[model samples]
Target: MSGNSSRRSPVERFFRMSLYVFAGLVLLQLSLALLAEIWPWLLGIGIIAGGISITVWWLRHRNTW
Candidate 1:
């Protein structure tokens, strides 16, 4: 049981890290959107890039998390 729990700890850590990364990406995209009035293209690019990054992260970590 102890060994199993130890193995699970890494998965939990990875999950927590991914969550933080996702949150940061969201904030960045929101900031870009807010600045879109000056550079209208940035909001669209940020949304697309953020979506792709989150999708890739989810795919890579889905099994572990």
Candidate 2:
């Protein structure tokens, strides 16, 4: 039989929610990064790209939490 089949506690749930939130933020940052390539009204692709790079790090780590 398996030895790790129990429900999560409240703290675990909190962590799970936070992880998803961070991941979502990362996706938003990524969208902003790509938006510059499609839209010409903006002039900050470099900044958005930098932001996406950093957020991607958080996204990968959050997936583990």
Enumerate residue pairs that collide in model 1.
none
The residue-by-residue lDDT of candidate 1 on 1-65, one tens digit each, is 57675565777889999999999999999988777766757677889999999999999999787
Give candidate 1 misplaced runs (Cα > 4 Å): 1-8, 38-65
Q: Which ten residues in a row have the lowest lDDT in candidate 1?
A: 1-10
Over 32-61, each residue of candidate 2 has an lDDT whose tens digit, in order, gives: 889867676454676788899989998999
Full-model lDDT for every candidate:
0.86, 0.86
Q: Output the lDDT of residue 26, model 2.
A: 100
Which residue runs does candidate 2 get wrong by more than 4 Å?
A: 1-5, 41-65
Give the top-scoring candidate (TM-score): 2
